[model samples]
Target: MNTVLVTGASAGFGEAICRKLIADGYKVIGAARREDKLKSLATELGDNFLPLQFDVTQKDAVDNILATLPIGFQQIDILINNAGLALGIEPAYEADYTDWETMVQTNIIGMMHLTRTILPGMVERNFGYIINLGSIAGTYPYRGGNVYGATKAFVKQFSANLRTDLFGKKIRVTNVEPGLCGGTEFSNVRFHGDNAKANDVYKNVQYITAEDIANTISWLVNTPPHMNVNSIEIMPIAQAPAGLNVSKEM
Candidate 1:
């Protein structure tokens, strides 16, 4: 079985992906900041799952942890960059600077760092797959989705550029962009722990579940080596881009 490395394995799409991959007989290195959650997952998954605890936002810690991968887990055939978050729902002018910074650091910088670290090995072996969790927010903008959307847009473009750079190589890069996904810590984190408000985001709506994304990743992994899925954007049927707003009496 090939070994796969997934970031943000503690919750949301990351957790679901881990479960699906392990079930399909793949050895997974699940990395997350929450050691306890990762430990629980490892316990449930048995020998196939190895838990590495570290915040992706911490560059030094990322390097140290990955550099010391044990002998059995050293070879990473696939990398799933699922460790991103949206901080706030306020417009740019009213948003916290720190929140914006956190999103950029984790969504863009951390993903790039981990990808860079893992690429050399893949290049040497001449085989690899890179899967990034982007968002439909990247393509469709909302009132308060400024920095978060921008970061995801970067993810989408970066994935495309990576494929171009790897032309002729067996390596594959895909950006999975999802919209209106629920059953994760996303809204809670964005709303800063306001559960009621967070809950409202999905109330009475049929939102996409983490399991849905997990299934998508599984399909990508099983796809033929010769085929490359450049980018996939998913959204709940109930959701669609809003029309342009105009001031009637300004």
Candidate 2:
């Protein structure tokens, strides 16, 4: 069975991807910071699902998790870097430096550390897939998304560079960018636990769901080996590019 490792497996696109991959017959290693959520997913998905608990921000913990994969789960055919978040929606001038730091650490540093750890093995194997979760904010910037957008832009560039570097190695790197996704903890976390505020962010707009992103990842992974889907940008119908006003009076 092909084994895939997914970070941020507790909820949102991560959880949905884990479920979809399991259903598609891949041995899945679901990694998340929340132990309870991981356990719940393992129970729900049965034997093929392995729940690993670790904070991606913790470099030592990430190293340990990658180093100690059980013999049966040793082969990692796919690595999905999905553990990332936007802490606060504040313009650069008014944004808290702490929030900026958190975004940088998780979205950029953590991702780099994990990719560095796993990529050598993939190179050695000469066949593996790496999917990085990015955002439309990376391509189109907006108010209150200063540092968050910058971080995702880093993801976009990094994924592209990886694909270029691995051109002849049969290692595929894909960047999946999604826009206006609801039904995830993203807005809630961005609002610092203000559920009402989070709800208001998407109140009028029809947003994409976690399952939608998960399905896209599944499709990318299932594509023929020779076909490498380099990048995909997904947006909800109700949303458009940055600075585009969709709610203007008719």
Specify the highest-lDDT model's number.
1
Q: Report the lDDT tens digits of candidate 2 across residue range 61-172.
A: 7887778888889888899999999998877888899999999999999999989988998999899999999999899988899999999999999999999899899889
TM-scores, all models, native as reference: 0.98, 0.96
Model 1, 1-23: lDDT tens digits are 88999999999999999999999
List runs of model 1 lying over 4 Å from the truth: none
Instruction: Give me the displacement of residue 136 in model 1, in angstroms.
Output: 0.4
Where does model 2 exceed 4 Å of error? Answer: 242-250
* Residue 226 lDDT, candidate 1, scale 0-100: 93
